[model samples]
Target: VLDRIYDFERILTRIETGTVSPKDLVALRESLAVIPQLKQVLSGASADLLHSLNDRLQTHDDVYDLLCRGIKDEPGLVIRNGGVIRDGFSPELDEIRSIAANSHAFLQELEEKEREKTGIKMKIGYTKVFGYYFEISHANTKPIPDYYVRKQTLVNAERYITPELKEFEVKVLTSQERMLALEYKLFGDIRRQIQGHIPAMQETARAIARIDCLYSLACAAYDNRYVRPSLNTKATISIKDGRHPIIEKYLKDELFVPNDVTLNHEDHEILVITGPNMAGKSTYMRQVAVLVLMAQAGSFIPAKEGSICPVDRIFTRIGASDDILTGQSTFMMEMKEVSYILKHATSRSLLILDEIGRGTSTFDGMSIARAVIEYCLKHIHALTLFATHYHELIAMADDSPKIKNYTVAVKERGKNIKFLRRIIPGGADRSYGLHVARLAGLPESLLKRADVILEDLEKNGGAPVPAKAPVNPAPSPMGDSLFSSPVIDKLLSVDVSSMTPIEAISFLYNLQKDAKEGSGIQ
Candidate 1:
């Protein structure tokens, strides 16, 4: 019924136009006309909430009747026109309009009487620049009547104003002006009466908005075959046959493969998901988070069966983005978000950290990923889904019983691989990055070169270090070459891991100064 309500916003806008339109007045009347029916239906509803809402809605009968009797059904757009007000709404305004209607005939009759009295070829004419004037030929100026006062002189005639003409002009113009003024005044009165019901209308609007949102959600769930999930305070989440709601909604050909997920505080607090790109790692984690959020929000989840632990907060560090203008690199931004999660997350929180340390070198990133997983398991104990391509993180499960390893299953065909899109209890054997790269249209020669590098690294365990470049010979102060000094070499080789951030900065500054001084470069 609320959805059927039309032109409410347009009516409000026309009120803001100050000089309200007849069409807008009629629109407001139509909207107000629906309120009585709405209130009656709501009042008769069996639900207590509906009954209470009905108590708050105003019918505004006086305003409605005023508008219905005053404004015409098809009142034209502007208010200045004479037909804007109905005939019987205002007697005084009607009388003024009647006088205005006969104004032309009255002026004609007065012109003829004046012409006979003056007898000097006088004629009455009207112009916007000069209201009503009597024109007398210049040849008859000597016999110009004393009653006529010259207003303007033309080439062959003198334009003159008479007291009778001025009085008639005031009566005609005043009547038309007052009629318009009265119509505007009546419209304002009706608009203000409607404005008085604003508080009730606002309340009704809020209730309708909430109802509309819930109805939309229910419709979506029904159309997509969703089920309601049970929510609890167990600090654990378990879902069976879960699928990504949005992805499933848009899938055209192949059926979306559903996956299962389990998270608890004691044994499986952290699931380190490892898989090749596009193998459904991110999608699975996101599905779990979405189901939990939906359950807590009192909406159905897109799953066969599910139970959610009501999470206090959900922290997602999913995508890669940076604040480059603020001088924060991508890695720094990632670390900052990580820091925020660590500081704010509680045991009851849900954390979805995807590619946590991916913005830096492999070893540094892997090390950070390991530390974050350990901290979440040992300190926070939050139910966390940590998805990454850093396959080495799977090793954390061996030492920590709270950590679990999961992977998206993949099947390899001759030179091509198919993503199974299945989550299972085990670490991924290997990331098929090369296969993904090939799929991404990498050149065959580049793929072969990468294959050679991978084979060599597999044989040697790691890349071999490059040989150091020869140092440039230069003058040194302190009676010795700085590059050859044992003290300088030891200083350069000191363990930086033991230094704090401030201490490291100071050490770097002092080292640069010392090198400059020793090389005699000032």
Candidate 2:
């Protein structure tokens, strides 16, 4: 009931805000009513009942009709005729009928009050075998006075349940004490009749519930102006410069700056993105993550075109904060998370780690970052995106075969920096912190001082440079030159392959001494 009411409120909001099309609203209404019909059938009938009646009643609509009539008219008829039944007729039958009739009336009234409180219109339908029931409405009518807005507000404002209403409910129950007792007796018989069909009834209920859930989710997605991504696997995550769905929709005209990112099993296994603060790195990552989640949950994504690899698990280590209560520092928490990923991530997993080592000092962070990249490259093989300010981490791709590096491009026009918000191959040249500081309303003198400090730090190698080379470089003809350079001549001349293991160790020690003493030659 709560879910249905919530869905109805969402639909109403959309209709009022012009976010939902009339056609969609009609479809939503129709879809919303399916579950109630399913519940009615599942609640009242047994599997044998359904099987026996299957040929006679082929459609869900038929079942719905039966429930509506059974609840509304049949029970009353049985109760009214109970007094006139023949001598051989059971008196309990009439008494059961009366209880059912009263219960049905009470339920109907409750449903109406609920609809009024929720601003969801309900259509009551009937049939035989199925008890009386109401649908939470998918009906459309010609515009009536106070039709959309007034009713929506009333729906929003009306209390779902109040103490006064609870009191009235108690009174209703007290007044129907005898009928309730009789109904409880009849409920037992009904349960027995339907016992054999429990599985079928459960299946029917599940199907209806699923339909209801899907419809409600779809309606909510549509109401929030969520764009439906095509359910195909073209390895395309194309949102035409679209904004983050959640952020953009709520903050109109604020411009979410859509981006396109694609990752598949083939060429695009990993994405390494680098950008300045507030340039949408986190937002973009989150956007993709949310889309993947939405898709998996059987929802439409907010993108122009999105084709996703159905990932098994999504691991995110994005934001930074200390657990003061737990007395764990940010770095400790990060390591804890990273350890889990390294241990558990599989080939099908998707990982997004942002500023992974920022919780610690530069050297420590960079070293840990290097080890992590190497580990990911060799073990725990998964599609990963490591976003960081420590550009030195990108160098892992040089030695590791599986790693890749990418940077979010930024445009610098003189003293001004324009965040392009474009992801490209290679690492970032600088963090551009000072430029960001200026943008953050820092004083000109302080900004200049920060720039001077930044330049000095760069000169002294305090800041790491971005990766400009291809992460997955092709094999070079001169690969052997790296090992055979003049610096290692003494080590090479030792001929360790010809020596026994013990002798080889001695030779290596001697070669290391020779090299240290500058006796090694090209």
Candidate 3:
């Protein structure tokens, strides 16, 4: 049984790697399901061989049957020494000969009796090669030669008769010819039946392939020391030393770095991961998602013996892109994804949001990020790993008991950043974007300019503020016109502190419209 499981694993790996199609995977799965039942009938190595043969036979039976049905009309076809034989004398040849002779004689007598009663002249000829003889019953009795009887009987280079038994031979040949034609009709019927059911046959084959794939996956999981992780009605994800199987395989010589993460019903439901760019935060989040999926799908996960409370759904919002053609900025796309996750994710779900709200201005992005964390904590109640550069979010751990803060550790030396790629219990010091920029080949002059701009921006309270209006302004009708539009009214009514990330977006759009309409407020 264990060995069978191993075989099943290999089959599934092939499927995962695209070496086998889904149809083949289904067949393999069905074969694995039968392995346990077949174990009792054969023992030891014999059992293994039998199981292997059964799998092959199940897979190839359709093709073999199609070929056999094509030739069924040729009556002499039979199994000989485990191989197919067509029309050759054998040990059972005498018995077949007797049956053919009797059949022909009966037909000949019937023909003669009918002709006598009707006053119609009829001629019957029999031969062994034709399998039966033919009966001629026509009013125009043309001169029939000896060669005519022999020529009609010959088919595919085999002689129909011997001279010694030529008379009987022609009669038998005629009868055989009639029988063969009838057999051919029956063969056509069978072929039609197969053709009609081709769709169903293909479906069944695909189903079997899926079964084979499952069996193989199960087997491989067993071999790799993989086990089914636990799941509960509550939302919780916990894993120890879990490695991403695909990434590990690609690394080849390098050892895979393992990470441990835990989200539970009591202590923590949300984890805010803050780390420098490229420090494995996203990879860690993805690993957890993949493990949950694997466990729910009934396959062993790549972990050093871990347990997970089953997730109803998995959502990942990891990358950034602008919808320029759609007239949506990068921030709009980010808000759209964030809104989707918050709306759809449930307590039994797992959410991975990497760098959410990073596309907007610092204050707006930080405010939006704060509200998102709060919503997940207070409303969705799902297990979440929120990876971000917003260090302010780390404070949520102090305020909310359900939120825990974590960071992927990075070693900083003077002006350099060295990614450790290991998760640790704390918050990140900074985003280190400049260090990464340097590594990306940013010119020294550009870095210097960026530093100068950063200093000026920090001195002016992080962002530029408009100069205050003159104290002695008396409002005219035109000045009042600046703030009277519907768009401006809606923007003024929006309260960012109270609204979630999604609501803030609607407010931002209304504000933008107000600005476009010659409103004074920006």
Candidate 4:
């Protein structure tokens, strides 16, 4: 019933302006009539908010019944019309209608008598151009009655008006016009009375709106099997069996795998998650953030269990998107989002980043990612979840006490890979990017070639060098020769900072010449 309330302001406006239609009046009455029952139901509510709203509600039974009795059961739209008001509402209106009914019968009888008296097939007609006139054909123009005054002439006919007809038209039109004026005045009075109660109706509407919202949230929790989460101010968020609320709902055939998350400002402020492409690292990170958001919003969280310290802000840099019209590339947009997060995130904030710095080359991207992780762990101390393909970043756990390493588990068959979607302790040993590519339908020849190149890279500690390419140049003769010079030893041991600029330059020039001569290069 509360949810059914809409367009109430429209009703109040129409009533205030004396333009209240039958439908608006009926809707208003129906809404007000439901108030007493609504109050009764709310009075028994367990929540204090609902009970308080019940006390604030005003039923206004007088106004409700006024609309019920004063207006017809199914009144027409216009109030100036007679059909708008009920028959018994006004004695004056009823008497006028009775006179008008008798007048209609009288006019019909008068037309029949005139037709018999003249025997010229006379007809009674009314039109806005000429009211209550008798139309006669031209062939019957002979022996016309003088009492019938000619009013209008047509090509083959003539129209005439009689004094009796004129008097009857005046009485009928006068009564109808007077009755309509009375009806309009009466309906306007009733609408004005209802308008006075608009404030109370608005208040009731507000209370019902709040109740509807609460009911909707409750329904979501119940239908989705969510549990209430514990909240505190301790700067920690921990959840057991946490699953992505939205993803889990859309999943078919396979159930979502739940994972555990733990983060605290003191010891484990930042968690570095590494795994293959589809191993659920991003999903696990997002689940933690969602649970935190829900708990802060005072709604039940979609987790088996959760206890979260309220975060001041939640920031995410998860997916890749470009603002093409705004002239920002994907990498630039990613950096902009990262910059905002780093600038605003506090110790009580929750930050979720996925594949940060992945838009650049391997070495540069890894370097930047490592620096960002260090900054967050050392300076911000925010509860952070970072999912990345950079497995080397997991080694930061050895240096930073607040950095923890975790990985999504996977199973490797002989030639196939299976994603377990489970977060486990420690860094992932391998990334399985090629396996993911294979799953994505990469050609077998390409996969095999990639495997060979990867083997060469591992052997050479970098990208593979061509088999025909010359090996590393023999050790530089300058290395052993320069070491044998006493001047070199002296130069290495000297406090160059203490020397004047000229003296330092002179020493450097002589040393370079001697080193070149000693190596037999000059």
What is candidate 2's lDDT per residue for 242-313, written digit by digit as tens?
446678767664555667776654555566677678676887778778887887787877667666667778
Please, what are the lDDT tens digits per residue for candidate 1 over residues 1-522? 656666455456556556556776776677778777777666667767567666766676776787888887887577766568777788887777767888877778888897687666677889988998988887885577787889998999889998989987777778877887888787677677667665555565555555456657788789988898887677779999998889997889888999999999889899999999999999998889888888887788888999888989999998877897999988898999999999999999999999988999878998999999988877888899999888988988999898899999989997699999999999986788899999999999999978777777668766764444669955335445456575478687878999999989988888777766766776
Ranking the candidates on TM-score from highest down gives: 1, 4, 3, 2
Q: Is candidate 2 or candidate 4 better by lDDT?
A: 4
Q: Which candidate tops lDDT?
A: 4
TM-score of structure candidate 4: 0.69
Give all TM-scores, in the order shown: 0.70, 0.51, 0.56, 0.69
lDDT of 3 by residue, 140-201 (tens): 35543354344352333222223434544454545455444544444334335445544444
lDDT computed for candidate 3: 0.65
lDDT of 4 at 275: 96
Backbone clash numbers for all candidates listed: 0, 16, 43, 0
Error of 1 at 28 (Å): 6.3
Worst 10 residues of 2 by lDDT: 144-153
Judged by lDDT against the true structure, how good is candidate 1?
A: 0.81
Per-residue error for 54 in candidate 3, Å, reads: 9.5
User: Candidate 2 local accuracy as lDDT?
Assistant: 0.59
Q: Tell me the spans in candidate 2 whose CA falls farther than 4 Å from its real position.
A: 1-205, 216-243, 265-267, 463-522
